[model samples]
Target: MVAGDGQGKNIHDLPDEIILDVFSFFSFNELIDILQNVCVRWKRLAHDPVLWCDKEYIVRGRAQNGRSCCGVTCSECAHCRCEKTDREVLRTAGMMPQLWTLTMMRGTRARILRKICRNCPNLTTLQLHGCQKMNYSLLKYIFEKCPKIEKLIIANNLLADRQYTELVSCLEHLQSLEVFENRRGAGPVLLRFLADTCSKLREINLSCDYHPLEDVEYFVKAKRDTLTSATVRWTMAGKRCVVPVLKEAASSLKKLQLRLFDVALEEEAATFADLGELHNLRELHCNQLCPHRPRLISLAFQPGCLPLLQKLDLPHATDLPDDAVVTISRGCPSLRHLSLTFATSLTDGALAEIHRLKHLQILDLSGCSGLGGSAVAHVAQLPALRTLLLQYIDDLTDLQPSLRHVLDLKQLRCLDILYSGHIRAVPFEEFSVRLVNFRELHVTYEEEDEVFYKNVLLRCRVKCLGSG
Candidate 1:
């Protein structure tokens, strides 16, 4: 009987596992729009719980009233039809049993959020951006349902005191929390609550006030052995509130970033000295948030301070003199990345000292007007130097000699000379031929230099920036 009517092969004839494997390559949107409608077997595969795990849905566009998700009118606007559509979408997608992350944008409805928490029990990370409707009840519902959540990010959302308190109480297992643009000062209470409840908490980024600074000090003291990274953005008046925290966490803290709105005076030199105690610190960023305030130049580090430090960023510190640069070069031998942007006092002599950091890969001397082509010769000496930024170094008129010197370093990759006014011309073809390993080259933008820059771009990646 000829083996009873043999038929041609079809995609459905493949094993279920193979079909699922193929489905894995398609994104959630693609699966919904194309693959699901292909056939019954594909539809069934699309609905499989494994495909939804780690899926991310990003909804863009502002609310109908032209106000963002965190706007005051958000809760009162019943006419926001877009909210309903978003809620419907969330309700449909929230049914994924294995979904682990949820990012809610500005106009997301409260009921929709409740549906998500109720549906997606496996959610471990929740990011709320401009989510105005995030009240105490909604937050409590999420915490009660999604008990495994470990990371929560709230940006540009002004939740009430009660809401913040409830939110903290619920995040008992949260390992990381970031609250940005929080004007209401929920930081102190939140830090205290996290310190008390979330013993596993290792990372925190909070807006700093005097009260919050006290809370942070206490938190660091209490959890000195656990907390590893902390980033504080100062908003209120404070002098030495941060120093005590650093002192307490000196042995354990690995990364620290402080954005100070106020100037650090000579009197606070002792406070700055406290950083020397952080021997385990690998990354340290000290930024002066208030431009009107003179940069904290009085702050100096002794030799062997932060010996293990790999990354140091102190941009726009106008008073970073040669002595400070020398101290940094002496102290941080293991440093790989260093940024001293806008350091007006940093001269060629400082670069000579910095060249001693053999492990240094990235260096930014942007806006250091005192530096000339002589500084590049010193930079060329660094064995591991890969990326060099010399933007706004106005005195650097002749770069060809320095560029020629750097060409010897086989590992050199990125070179930036943007806004260097005095460099009248560049040997683009010569640079392209010599610097075989170059990945990016940045030059100052000029109408006349278009052809020169275009030629470089054709040979290698090039970016042009306007002279400041």
Candidate 2:
């Protein structure tokens, strides 16, 4: 019995499947650390295909570690360890044959990538960010190897017009794609390919260098069946060209995003003129475009469309006339969350309408310089408001520090009043002592001045008045 137990100890103590399960809990770095210390049997077990089933590549080092770290330049820095750490790391990782996902920075060595692809035949999800060194050959190799890829993020400046078309033509099964500006491909060509091939595509983040609006239109028309979300951030040159395309394609889209440089509100608003036609649209975001305030009046008050609306984010919608707010509140009673950043046009009257929004959980009014103490006071009264951002508002008048009373929001989770100007001082001791139920709080006031904020909340919590 003793001899048999010794022989069993000499062999692997656990089953192969159990060993793989144990290794899955450790990260690649942790596995590498284990490999450096463990014996041959453990190292081989660590390199099992089950352990490398989901390869997650992390891209670090930008400013400090460059040529190969951030941009296209590839200069070796011994101190800077990007993706190209050492040959042994690559050799050991190159064993898995059934790779499901490959997420690596473009800065990684092509040799390493070749090994990875050769080993992993069933790769499904591929994400390469800031991979400027990758050439057409690597992309072609990836397409050939991973035909079943469902999600792809290639932010490498490698694919030209021809290579871009060829590579995209191969990824017919992709459901989601995110291509950053690092790639050197014609946006229109990629869009055209997506329209032609990717029928199951649902979400796309085409943040690459701008493409002509005509291409945008074609792609939108192609994915009209399943395309719901698109995030398009064009370069300065691309913005002007894509607006016309958006105007034509806006009718069918449910979720759309644009990053503008010096574009006008009128032109941006025109893109959404056909937005009302997107009857199935539930979410809409405009990063920097002038908010379609006038259209808000029509869309909000009148029974046009967007009955299934839930979330609306209009960051640059600066001039939301009071009537428009009323229209929206009266019209879309089903809205759950609303984000109105830099909305300079919203007045105290808008707050009255906001109260009617019983379902609103998150309200972001960041950069709205027009909102003053009165508007803020009204906001505090919102019963359903959970998260509120009031950054960059200048004018704030004297409201007693114990504002926890007038604004009876026990459900509040987060409050941001940074840079909202001087909050009038009230006695730290007499401040409305409520049960401090908040989880997160951000105040732009100084430590010395924060007596009205921190101390009051802390002291009130002791009394347990506002305890939820």
Provide the RMSD of all predictions against the true structure, rounded to 1 decimal.
Answer: 7.4, 8.1
TM-score of each: 0.75, 0.68
- lDDT of residue 104 for candidate 1: 61
For residues 97-159, write the lDDT of model 1, one tens digit per residue. 566666665546677667767877777777776645666667778788889888777753442
Candidate 1's displacement at residue 31, Å, is 7.3
How many clashes show up in model 2?
Answer: 3
**Backbone clash count for every predicted candidate, in the order shown:** 1, 3
Superposed Cα deviation of residue 80, candidate 2 (Å): 19
Against the reference, the lDDT scores of all candidates come to: 0.68, 0.59
Clash pairs detected, candidate 2: 67-73, 106-131, 435-466
